[model samples]
Target: MSETLSGQATSTISAVVGRADVLIVGGGLSGAMLAAQLLRLPGRRRILIVEPRAELGRGEAYSATELGHTLNGNAARMSVDPDNADDLTQWLEAFIAKGGWPESDQQHVPVSELFPPRGIFGLYVQQRLAEAREQGAVSGSTAEHVCGEAVDLHIDSSGARLTLADGQCLEGAYAVLATGMFPAARTRQKHSSGLNAAAIDPWDVAAMSRLDPQGTVLIIGSGLTMVDAVVSLEQAGHRGPIRVFSRHGLLPHVRRQPPAWEDFLAADQSIRSPRQLLREVRRQCAAALASGIDWQAPLDTVRAHIGRLWSQASDVQRRQFVRHVRPWWESHHHRSPPLSAELVERLYKEGRLTIEAASLKGLDEPRDGRVSISIRPRGESRARTVTGEALINSTGIEYDWRRVDRPLPQQLLARGLIRPGPLALGIAADPGGAVVDAEGDVSTRLFAMGPPLRGMWWESTAVTDVASQAKALAVRLAQLMDSQKGRG
Candidate 1:
């Protein structure tokens, strides 16, 4: 096994290569939005999106079948256009008005509310692409959606080469890596038992919903996913008690009714280190508490500048920040929907929900039907056991793409086509999302964005932030493709 980030290649590169003006590697929200933005370009550029999944926009976040899985952020904040403040709302309203649904401009909506399902969100995004095509956004420009996984990328002087899992290859002047969250870590306890099945990843909602409603369901993590699961279970008429366990045992804070102090983090200088940044944030948090402003206000400020702050930090500083402050920061910034918050509170008040701060020891499968889970306290040597019918590991996604079990990233690293960022944040790429080579050089064609750049740009996950990146990347890729065609 290669211990280093980059390694020598023993395998031969693929020979059956095709070409395109632009090749987007993932068809999730970021990739689709980038494709939409590309349609706005003047010339006809053949755009190809390599998405292994059959559906687009229904990434891990929007792919849930549960109607109770509402967006944590407001609909107004999820617009593809950062410039257009009411893009999603306008679209949603038009859609709702056409469907003759009740119209209210309320900020927060419940998970039970009959708004657009995530699959519908996928349809809306795909429809936008179709509308763009009909409007001559890319006149005579062909847009192909190939259902395949891009396993390897080959960067050269001419362009970048993409190797699909089926041995089909695609070459493009530019590429976007928008692979969202990967599957979470599977529990070691489940490895031995053949009967007890559980979902450790957010994307595996079907498996999660299979748990008995009368039996106790244990959620391994307490964050957005936990809250989402609670809403889903309740909607499914799951009257059983829900138990959530984590190190901190703190649920995510909720979004306020009216957004307050939108410009709190607009500081004079954006070059502060992580320590200084945390100090300043605490100061603002204290001030917000004193001034009757919600703590989320000042936290949002820090989030806005997280990219700049992360970029400015040294490798050591970034590692320290991740080790010491990431969880607390995430709990504050990535909040739950107000409705979900209320549901969790209601569950707790009714004794249907219990939060624990003990360390999970292991899983014990008894001769009986139930599964007993062992847990030990932080400071105690004694381990206590709880028997539950099911366990759901809502411990979020594996953010580190290098650790991803897929073959493409591994092949790319072997070929020196891409390198990871400092502090293993994500794949190393230039500011424009161009993939950097192993020799510490930016490739002319290969690019990446979304959570893959979390190391470089810490705040790229939210729709508000990613939309800008997508727009900018699309504009640049369009220009690059046009320039290449002009030369050809």
Candidate 2:
């Protein structure tokens, strides 16, 4: 009895109806996009997409209530079209034509500009997905969307069966897992003291809504999440000081204006280990700066070929980079909106914002209802305590599911269907994103995409990267299903 958002259970009629040609387990951006691509194919096929969320397109990344939450990339670079480079721009134009935005805000902005409102992109994705669903209806193939969590997967020589949480079962020739980012649980470290309430996980809307207007908020990490926290606080009328603490104490750089375009790093040159790739990025960043342009030009170059770059890396090199270099790489590669960064810098200069290089040591709850945090600086042995009216974790989403310490993963691990990646970095998978089983062999039908496969591919988080992977995976599935049908 799998259930939809309405809590209406779906009976075990799928098997009787015949298995879906493809069953997608997570209906976030990747899963939704993949479904759209499959429906666009020129053949009749039954597809079922299983997602627990009531909302479809937003998922974890794009779902945001605040207007301040914008996309990390600009509209031009965020297009869904693999063919038309200006797809997002065209999409925006069409949206504006439909009277979707204010005329004053309709200035021509380059796609390379880092747009900060993720809700806008979420709306775009929803519109596109809805259109695709209509297209699917017109075609011979039919798509059924199930609102339920896929709790278990059983696979044999014939096909794969998915067991939903409510006990409804769905059998499909193929399935793809697109579980997005899951944030790490707050630690009991000293630095987190007085910060428990301040810790605002990205997914917690209730927590964010409880923020006090005049409270001094301490953010745990400095990244895109921190950027989001800052913007959200401002929107929430937080006038007090906001502090961001992290190991590197480095915030993401802002996108430069008049977007610099350099095709220096060819797509083929992207194939290399993480170390080699980091060196290439460094060289390119330096070259861009030397040539009197901002460092973002090189990053844009890298994003164009990130999938190939990750696919080519050896597993050992991939692990090494995740451990030693991921934090720094993330700050530079996933940047913030220029205006937002400027606001943060202004807050810093005005003494309303402070970024500290330290690890959280403790969190103390005050009787008066405030939290106190203890932090030990990177080098000094001495610890310091800072009291904030509020503490927002803003540490960003954690990909390492092992840290989630959830029952489902534990159960799956025992069943030998899935394994944690190197150091529990992310869900383990092969280059093509087929989940590695407990016995260390790649499962044939169980596939995963998006941030869940971060361990397998170091650069798998962003929408552009994930969309490309989803499209490629759709092609593979189409080919695989076609071959199977031919055999039958």
Measured by TM-score, the strongest candidate is 2
Judged by lDDT against the true structure, how good is candidate 1?
0.70
All candidates: TM-score: 0.86, 0.88
Model 2 off-target regions past 4 Å? 1-6, 9-18, 103-116, 185-198, 201-211, 257-280, 305-316, 365-367
Question: In angstroms, how far off is 325's CA in candidate 2?
Answer: 3.2
Model 2 weakest lDDT span, ten residues long: 185-194
lDDT of 2 by residue, 287-362 (tens): 8788887777777776666555565666777677766777777777777776677878788899999898988787
Pairs in clash, predicted candidate 1: 151-408, 425-455
Tell me the whole-model lDDT of each prediction, alpha carbons only.
0.70, 0.72
